[model samples]
Target: MSEPLYHVSANPHVRDNGSTQKIMLDVIIALLPATIFGIYIFGAPAAKTIVITIVTCVAAEYIYQKLMKQPVTISDMSAALTGLLLALNLPPEVPFWLPIIGGVFAIIVVKQLFGGLGQNFMNPALGARCFLLISFAARMSAFTYDGVTTATPLASLKAGESVDVLRMFEGFIPGTIGETSAILLIIGGIYLVARKVISPIIPCVYIATVAVFVTLFGGHGVDIQYIAAHLFGGGLMLGAIFMATDYVTSPITNKGKVIYGIVLGILTGLFRLFGPMAEGVSYSIIIANILVPLIEKVTMPTPFGIVKGGKSNE
Candidate 1:
């Protein structure tokens, strides 16, 4: 009977309620509010950019896997999420081809080439965004609305121009599509935490650290509210909730997570206060991503029946 042609698998007989598909689906849903708000704020150009990015990303992933004779993983929707995130991080006035190039870089260089899902070293979207920022500084820094140029809130702040906090919250600021509305981003972040999709520790610790550091050393003109403004403004919420918490690139151990959050916060604060750029969340998260492996090793949990330097008895 050929041993009944059935085999047993490994232990972990039970599995949790989450799957990659479900988690990715939840993430797509979570991104909706901010995306919709972005379109409303930036109009048709924002919508077109998002669509192009996503299509290019999905197509690129599909074509790459086909050429390599590997099973297509596009059904997982991770590529779509990465594409959308990349688009959201871009300015509305970015050249059309710029997003296509970024999407290809994300789907090919950062993701598929690394063996796909859960194997990427850094968040693909953030990696692509950083690349675009470096390669096209002029386009990346140029903010616009309805074909009219304007200074980003961060740029204004850096240039020592006064800004109205109320307008920033209301999404009148010229910045990246999803970064303009601090209020909307916060609401989405809270939803993700509430749904257990992400840990609150990272967000809380990172934001608090930035707030406190800015308060202490940002300047005599820097007030507590200004620190709060930094927290709620720009891409801080988006990066803390999404990019920093990316499972593949972030620390797994609890202690390591806290440390990662703290370091990310400090770097972000320093960059904003001292660096030329007004925002630092993306850079901070990428820096922390590179340290996750080391952090995990140092903070590894002790195994059962094992001493600090001894082996366990079987």
Candidate 2:
């Protein structure tokens, strides 16, 4: 009798490295420094706001998924990250309930409604932020901390007033918790970049483009150095590094990434200069998110040896 032939079937493939859980964990770790800095700058209220935002976001995600009969994904920590980011983007003195509402919008509407994980069209936290900005402009614009109200860096800059560069770096300014200190945000961003958690293309190109645009305009007797200051002020670093680089919302192709970055920068500059609001990072990123698919299609690489009609080689 002939020996039976032996064959190994390779059908299903499974990939295991780090999960969404792990990636989210790393992101949370990367954000820790800024969180600590925020607490230090804004004191106990900042901590309270952070906690409330996180709990509300997680609760919203859990409730929404449970209601839809989808397996609750809170273990992935994505909701927590979204909550943390939303909190960071908010004024330290914001009412506690506002972030809860934003979180509901983020997890329920922007994230899960379109399909959970990997399927959302835009960054949930940023989308929620944009929504909140439009819905509650008064609350969003009322900047305060520890009972002291002040204009944001962008507002001051636009008003032809000056900011103390040293104080801004030290997080003494009144703005969003994680956005006030350019130095701390850069440090955290660098760590994320070094860990290969995020690409530098967006942040570097975005900031540079803004700098160039502001320089070219040269309005109100602002110089290049002043333009540079604007680059580090407000939420530019946070949005460029975190929100704009959101994997699901950003372009996949290299050329597309550059286009995305450039467009965001230009829009941010235009809004800062001409729009009613002084800060524009959230709006700019959301706009870029909306265009990512189109950008990817336009910038897609040509398929090898394939003509428009799929003609064969001559």
Candidate 3:
């Protein structure tokens, strides 16, 4: 018999032109608008945090890989993305060293220690944000805008004070660097969806779930301002659109994604309404990320020619 012309060796024989570097670059590009706006609004402090955090993340990853004798992958831009996200989540007035600590923790502890990028169980940025929040509660909760220390829009809402919903939507309110601008975040999210870098399922469903949850249990009956505040305030938009939709941490199947979104929405609502803190998006998404495995297992589709109970066609 003649030799075969070709050989198939693995299940993942299908391939595409997409690369990790390309996807990361696309995300970074999409984030640029919000990043620039954040810097513009927050001034040199924001710029400093962003620059330092990104550098620290890339440096941490490179140094770790070099020390471990692994192939250095800083060019992939995942570390940079992680740093940017962590910095964006930080308070603009945070000490310069905060992002440095966060970047190192995100890359080394949450990401590389778990076997690097795709193997990270939870979103590294969120995980590190949670860590920083726990370690620096007062610092993380402090907010300043326009050279004055003040409560965030969500905090005002929690304190039974009404806020300018329009201003909040317009990102004029005090909050984290990147999360204040609903319009810009949504624009970035739309760009990501148009580029097909992410599915709209998680972000759309997650936001919708939060809207519905807050409307029902928020003690405000069909109030547009209240619902919009919940939607636009805090880190909900940023986390839902960016971190929750992360490819490695989010569920793969459509069914799993829906369930994950619902879980995130409910948890966020619970935390915001009843917990000690007014913000909950980070914790909610991190919790849901931990549940991705079980969600995928339950929502896994059956193979072709396989019956429900695993009986095959005769």
Which one wins on lDDT? 3
Could you tell me how far off, in angstroms, the CA of residue 87 lies in candidate 1 after the best superposition? 0.5
The true-versus-predicted C-alpha distance at residue 180 of model 1, in Å, is 1.3
Kindly give the number of clashing pairs for every candidate: 0, 0, 0
**Candidate 2, superposed: residue stretches over 4 Å from native:** 1-16, 220-222, 309-314
Candidate 3 structure quality by residue, lDDT tens digits, 1-314: 99879874421111458778888888888888878988888899989989999999999999999999999999989899999999899989899888999999999999999899778899999999999999989999988899898999998899999889898888988889899999999999999999888889999999999899989999997999999999999999999999999988988889999999999999999999988888999999999988999999899999999978899965
Judging by TM-score against the true structure, name the best candidate. 3
List clashing residue pairs in candidate 2. Answer: none
C-alpha positional error of residue 229 in candidate 1 after TM-score superposition, expressed in Å: 2.3
- Rank order (by TM-score, best first): 3, 1, 2
lDDT of 1 by residue, 132-184 (tens): 99999899888886678987777677677777777777677788988777777
Clashing residue pairs, backbone N/CA/C < 3 A, model 1: none
For each candidate in turn, the TM-score is 0.92, 0.91, 0.95
* Model 1, position 47: C-alpha lDDT score: 94
- Model 3: weakest 10-residue lDDT segment is 7-16
Colliding residue pairs in candidate 3: none
